[model samples]
Target: MKLNIQQETAQDFNAVFELNKLAFGQENEPKLVELLRKSSAFIPELSLVAWFQNQIVGHILFTKIKIVNNENDTESLALAPMAVLPEFQQKGIGGQLVNSGIEEAKELGYKSIIVLGHEHYYPKFGFEPAEKWNIKSPYDVPANVFMALELTPNGLENTSGLVVYPKEFDTV
Candidate 1:
């Protein structure tokens, strides 16, 4: 599918909400996206939408999250709740959004991105087990599903810690 990906705007909110709702087959992710938007964790530019045939078909959000240890609290991006309409699944739109979001993160000087998603799907984008960097997710998930990717060489070096998602995440 040919998609035109763009940074989401206020004008896109309704569509984004509906698109997420439909894609995920539930309201949690859509509601989470809405809450994140109003929180400090929100990165407007990283909230992207994919338009296919003049309609919203996909949405992806990368929000600010903290990786904390007793010694330090490092910032990283959390790639969460990425949604592509059910009908649009498996056609590379999700991958495109991920790549575009990664480039944007690098451009904005982010060091790494964390994701709790498919063990198989995310590896193609260079996401490795977060444990490789001693990074752990707050939720007890399998090592493979909770992955991390460095935006720069050794970006996650010496960055061991627990991921602390914002309070808004509890909603979903």
Candidate 2:
């Protein structure tokens, strides 16, 4: 099965939402995607859809997130709310979406990326615990689930703080 990952547009929006809903078995993710779309943190190209036969079958959103330390300077970007349609779950579409996001971030000169996700799945893309860099998430997620990847060396060097997701995420 061939898959194409592309920048999402207005026409693809509803299909992406429905894909997330089916993948997660709830309406929650669909709503979260809507909220993120309106949030100031939304990164246009980073919001991607995976297409199979031109139908959106997976969705991944990379919104601007912040890590504020004692100094209060904000270091940004954390990946979240990634989902794939139930029928597409075991395929490598999810990995392609994530890799595509990382490439976009790199080209845009983003220093680091953080993710709160399955330990096994994320590490395949080189994510290690954010704690290794003294970065943290405000919520009590498993230590293993809160992970970070430096697109450049010392991306979080000497940066210690909490990951603050955008306000849209607070709606969940």
Best by lDDT, which number? 1
How far off is residue 30 in model 1, in Å? 0.6
- Expressed as tens digits, the lDDT of each residue in 1-172 for candidate 2 is 5888889999988788888888888988789889888989888988988888868888898888888877875656778789988877888989999999999988888888989889999999999998998898898888999999988877778778888888877777
Worst lDDT 10-window in candidate 2: 69-78
Off by over 4 Å in 2: none
Give a tens-digit lDDT track for model 1, residues 56-148.
Answer: 888999999999999999999999979988888899999999999999999999999999999999999999999998899899788889999
How does candidate 2 fare on TM-score?
A: 0.96
lDDT (0 to 1) per candidate:
0.93, 0.86
- Using all chains and alpha carbons, the TM-scores for the candidates as numbered come to 0.98, 0.96
lDDT for model 2, please. Answer: 0.86
